[model samples]
Target chain A: MLVNQFLILGAVLFCIGVYGVLARKNAVMVLMSIELILNSVNINLLAFDLMNGGLEGSVFALYIIGIAAAEVGVGLAMVLLIYRNKKSIALDELSEMKG
Target chain B: MLASDIVVAQNVAFGIIAAVMVLFALRVVSSSNVVHAALSLVMVMAGAAALYILLAAEFVAVTQVLVYIGAVMVLFLFGVMLTRAKLGRDADLNNKNWAAGIPVALLLLGVMVYVLIDGLGDDKLDVTSGTAASTAAISDLIFSPYILPFWALSFVLLAAVIGAIVLARKD
Candidate 1:
């Protein structure tokens, strides 16, 4: 019933996810953290939407879902390409962006 | 506490899910293997979806499960497998990461809390009314005012699929 509780939870999740993104070196792990952050946003959207009695928030969250899917699509492709060329997926290794 | 039962329940639920999310995130950072990290992230996302359901956004909750847990987690799993990456490359969860990472995240948390508490300090955000009409109103807005964006989002999904396939396709 309290929107702030949900929002705070979302903020905590997003922060944790951010830490994962910044601290972890594996590109794959970074992608997973990115998923966490996005889901955190979705939680906020849905909570706010519920309080407002509107579909717009859930609807926006739906768009976010689409965006997340698309992100993974391209992200996984990039990871695969990087893996094929570099034989690795560690973030430390791919500074030059070639192969 | 007695006066705020719903709020208390919501807080407890949020606490549990937040802990789970953070724990899985820790697992993600600490695990060396890409596959393990991917699996751990599934728990994080699923916990987030559960939070959505707690908020009574039933549609969003289902979408979270279907879109994220069902589809996206698998994408991560397969991506890790396809890359043929080694496991356990980053098993260290020491204070160095905490020293650099925790402060920044904590700072962000502080900022968000201040903004939320300050923004809604005195105003009451009623959650009791509009229980029954929520679904109907949401459907109406989706079909009418927000239709274009709704369809555009689908296109976004399609484009991402094509782009990913193109990127990963073997020569």
Candidate 2:
């Protein structure tokens, strides 16, 4: 019962992340959305691990968290550095990378 | 059936939290204030942790709370506060924010929903997950088979910490 609950929650989080990634104009906000996406995946892993007769999901979640931490660190640093140089945190302004 | 009833109830609960998570995610993106976005992201993370708890993976749930709530969020907020990114800029809203990403997300969402609906009905495995067992098992795994990945991840974090410091320095 609870596992199902968690699965739905994870799915919901992923959708929200999708919205954030798609809708947000600020790069930092996009990063936050990415965090949401990652968290949803973590929730699923933990939930499924419990249901799968093993701790594989939880273990994977741990490593994912480590990766997420590093990602946030590097991402926020990049945003801050970019903000410093360009005085704008808008995704629209950071088109230099895409082009 | 009692099991069916329980499933229904839990599904309702998950639905509610999912709503909040998505709502906050929307706020995080649509709001002009970077701090507001960061705050919404907190809601998102906490909601995710709540789902973890529901899954009976108490250790992972607690770790989620500790890592994202305790550490990641603080780091994000500090960066936001320090940088003083634009709080409000209505000069334009037209950007490539959702241009190429919306359809992909929807496609993924459909896939996820399909998988969850199909995969989670029958319980072939028992969840013996709790603080003690999980902690012990996780530690054992890390010390034995997963040790390399653990250390590699730690080193990556260390590198990130160092890089962030260097990037933020007054140079």
Candidate 3:
């Protein structure tokens, strides 16, 4: 069991998530990127837990999944509200807060 | 198969799944259609769950499947459909300065790999592992020492539900 392999895999996923967050203009896509980032962190936690021979990491990962669900719920609701108001979900066009 | 063969097979499985995961993750970000992106995200989530199983965290993997792929993806599709996203490609799906992010993303990846490798090089898991804490032990931990945070998480979920309803409801 090569632990470094798993770590590198998680790192790659995290970087891709970061790229998605930065590059995507769709609010939903940004939320998706956040999920990817969260999943990568879960992977890291599980890997470390396996290395340390304990269940602490798995428990933490479970909580993270719960929080992610709540977060996406709220996030999607906000996106819906934005769409209702502005008729678009594009982040670039949501710059009304720009000064 | 022999025990050694099982390890080799696990490595191969990990390699294939990781490759597929990276590909779908890229598609999730770069795909022209929002629906396609959401579906691709499902694939990524499933792959993540598979990786968790590989890590010997079967219960976590099952929760991931149920919560992420089953529920979260459905919620995303609902949001996408309700938002009336254009079916075909959307021209404004990326920012004008998206190109600049490529370098930043690469830099972040490089830095992460460097630090992670230096910090935890070749650390092998203890093969003489004791019996993994069963679901019962995990539940006890969650209920005993971690109960406060657990309750707090429930409150957060409730708050999110109410907030979603409030925000999404028509006036």
For candidate 3, write residues A1-99 as lDDT tens digits.
667888899999999999999998889889999999999999999988888887888888989999999999999999999999998888878767893
Instruction: Give the poorly placed runs of model 3, Cα more than 4 Å off.
Output: B1-6, B126-133
Order the candidate numbers by lDDT, best to worst.
Answer: 3, 1, 2
- Comparing 2 with 3 on TM-score, the higher-scoring candidate is 3
The TM-score-based order of candidates, best leading, equals 3, 1, 2
Ten residues in sequence with the least summed lDDT for candidate 1 chain B: B90-99
Model 2, residue B142: distance off in Å is 1.5
Docking class of 2: medium
lDDT measured at residue B160 in model 3 versus the true structure, 0 to 100: 96
User: What is the C-alpha local distance difference test score of candidate 1?
Assistant: 0.75
lDDT of 2 by residue, A10-33 (tens): 776677688777777666677888
Q: Evaluate candidate 3 and give its CAPRI docking class based on DockQ.
A: medium
True contacts kept of each: 0.68, 0.61, 0.82
- Evaluate model 1: give its TM-score: 0.86
Task: Please state the error at residue B134 of candidate 1 in Å.
Answer: 6.0
> Which predicted model would earn the best TM-score?
3
Per-prediction CA RMSD (Å): 3.2, 3.2, 2.3
Candidate 2 regions with alpha-carbon error over 4 angstroms: A2-5, B1-16, B87-104, B115-133
TM-score of 3: 0.94
TM-score of each: 0.86, 0.83, 0.94
Q: Write the per-residue lDDT of candidate 1 for residues B65-152, one digit (tens) a residue.
A: 8988898888888887787665556454223344587788889999998998787554333454435335566678878999898788
TM-score of each model's B chain?
Answer: 0.77, 0.76, 0.91
